[model samples]
Target: MKYLVREKMFSIGDDFWIEDEHGNKAFYVDGKVLRLRETLVVQDPHGRELAVIHKKVISVRDAMTVERDGEVLVTVRKKLFTPFHDSYRAELASGDELEIRGDIIAKEYDIEYGDERLARISRKWFRLRDTYAIHVDRDDADPAMLIAIAVCVDRLVEHEHEKHEHEREQHER
Candidate 1:
């Protein structure tokens, strides 16, 4: 199923509404305020938390963890020095590793487990800025997990771009 993730504007903390293809609000991503590190909680319409995503504090590479019920489901880390495209490595608690590759700047990417494509995230399908669609193969992946992964990936990519821009400004000064 494809869901639309629309980011909120003019908010101190990041907030998003995940909508179904019919434009019905399906899930809500609440970015916790006043945290040392970035953190977000995904909840159902009824307000029950489905998953929690937070940046890893002590990782050498940019990393984030997804958890449900205090159990880590997966850890996603950015792959440095990938040629031509952005890459990420995800380690699942089940010992299954996945690779994510695509144009992160354009928000077009796929999550793959070996040869199988588990999920696809893209903004090309929508005309609205800051809005993207996440398509998860329900037969191959859990929708909630994939959505959380997309959220983490989006934040990481944005953070990296900002970091680069800051460094560039420093160099120009």
Candidate 2:
């Protein structure tokens, strides 16, 4: 199954509409601003909350957690010192671990379970900015969960990029 994730620009905070391959709205992402830590809630089309994502504090590495019904479902942490591609580790609630690595800057990446690829995320498929595509193996993955992960990864990467840009500006001054 394929879905298009598009972020709405010029809003008070991050907001996204996840659309199916047919362009029908499938899910809604409501980003909570004015919070201590970054937080986002993903809701189904009918407005039922599906997952909650929040930044993990007190970690040496950048990390975030996905929760459902107040229970931790997955914890995603970035691997420091990746010389080549950006890499991340995701610990699932089922005790199964997954690896995420690829061209994060270009938004082309894959979520893999050992030797099997469960999802592919890419921005090359769309020409518009702040938009990307997520193709998942429906038989092997839950679309909602995968979508939540992708959203969290995107936000984290974007936040890091903004921070670096600010630091660069400060250095120039």
Best by TM-score: 1
Per-model TM-score on C-alpha atoms: 0.92, 0.89
TM-score, predicted candidate 1 vs. hidden true structure: 0.92
Clashing pairs in model 1, backbone N/Cα/C closer than 3 A: none
What shift in Å separates residue 113 of candidate 1 from its native position after superposition? 1.1
Candidate 2 local Cα displacement, residue 165, angstroms: 1.8
Which residue window of length 10 is worst by lDDT in model 2? 7-16
Residue-wise lDDT of candidate 1 within 82-130, one digit each (tens)? 8777898788999988888888778889988899889898989988987
**Cα lDDT computed for each candidate against the true fold:** 0.84, 0.83
lDDT of 2 by residue, 90-132 (tens): 8999999888889877889998899999999988888898788
Question: Positional deviation of 82 in candidate 2, in angstroms?
Answer: 2.1
| Predictions: Cα RMSD each | 1.8, 2.0
